[model samples]
Target: MGGLLGVLLVWRVASALFGGGEPGLPSGGGTPASPTPTDDGGNGVPASTVEVAEDFPLPAIGTRLEFKILGLGDDPKRCEAVGLLVGDDQRTAYHHLCGDAEAGTDVYFFLVRIVNHSDAAQPIALASFEMTADGGDTLPALDVETANATREHYFPERIELGPDSRIKKFVAFDGSPPFTPARLTYVDGTQALVIHLRGTWIGA
Candidate 1:
């Protein structure tokens, strides 16, 4: 029974990562449409989906993070970093970049939204995710209590999502210097997901 349970567990994680739906690529021969810009100046900053080339294949078991620019309160002298995931596709991770220069802090708040596209329920743990910087620094995610104390937005520990259902939570990281982050990574034993941010500016 123990061995059976272990096999079952691995199967679930695999399903969550690969997903059961068709690939997110265009089906016809024509190129995919360009992502529409959603920047209305409501937040005093432009917002738009980063355009991936039509031929860029979506990662089989990974997520994408997109950053946004937010005005810092009434202080026109200060800037606030904000972002969100590109789409609501299941099995894809989403994230936001946040930091306070005055406080000498910068961090990545990853909102991992897992949807069980498989037939059974899948259990996920925070231990399955990892964040690393360009300088070979392996950053540790803050515990729920510590993250909550530091930022108003944070996610709790483990989670489980049923088939056709989804759950979203935040994972906080203090990996690199403010606006100097290089890469983000996630692993689920069988597969690995890496998001590259080299040569990218935070509030640009």
Candidate 2:
């Protein structure tokens, strides 16, 4: 599992660095050839479904998975100020209190939407997800308490998502300057999902 995640992380980082549509390939119009199957483990998925071209296919927006990631958006700024809703009659602009990015670094607010498609319930632990930086180091999601202090939308430390249900919330991560972020990754045992988010955010 660790080795597989490492390989996919490299591919994701390469895609970000080169701005490619599929790893090293540039974006273009062409009917790509079909993927051929091979003898390889699929992290519980059938081997036939994991083709050579897409050994680890990215989950598209709205696609169903046990715990699917529908979208993500990043708000990268230093001590960024924003308006907040107070009660039902007032809204005020104030410096957010979520958490502070390290000096010389920026804080990234990742708005992530997830869906549970299985028949049983599953736990969505914030620790399962992390932002991988160019330097190969990772930053875990911020604690729920610090994040909730901002009073902005935030995911709890852990929560259960019912089958066929969906949720959306913000997750905070401290950004590493001079070292671009390569991707946001979620891992559950041997199964893994990769979200390429180096130059831009996906979903919304």
Best by lDDT: 2
> Each prediction's Cα lDDT score?
0.37, 0.42
Off by over 4 Å in 2: 1-105, 176-178, 198-204
Per-prediction RMSD in angstroms?
A: 16.2, 14.1
Tens digit of lDDT per residue, candidate 2, span 1-204?
232222222221111221212222123312223434435432332444422121112332212332222221123232333322223322111122223323354444544566676687777878877766656677787664542143335677788888888776666565434335455655544444455433332221
- Which pairs of residues collide in candidate 2? none
Tens digit per residue, CA lDDT, model 1, 67-103: 1111111111222333222343222222222223223
Q: Estimate each model's TM-score.
A: 0.47, 0.50
10 residues in a row with least lDDT, candidate 1: 66-75
How does model 2 score by TM-score?
0.50
Report, for all candidates in order, the number of backbone clashes: 1, 0
Cα-based RMSD of candidate 1: 16.2
Question: Which stretches of candidate 1 lie above 4 Å from their native place?
Answer: 1-79, 82-102, 146-153, 175-179, 202-204
Candidate number of the best TM-score: 2
Q: After superposition, how far is residue 138 of candidate 1 from its true place, in Å?
A: 1.2
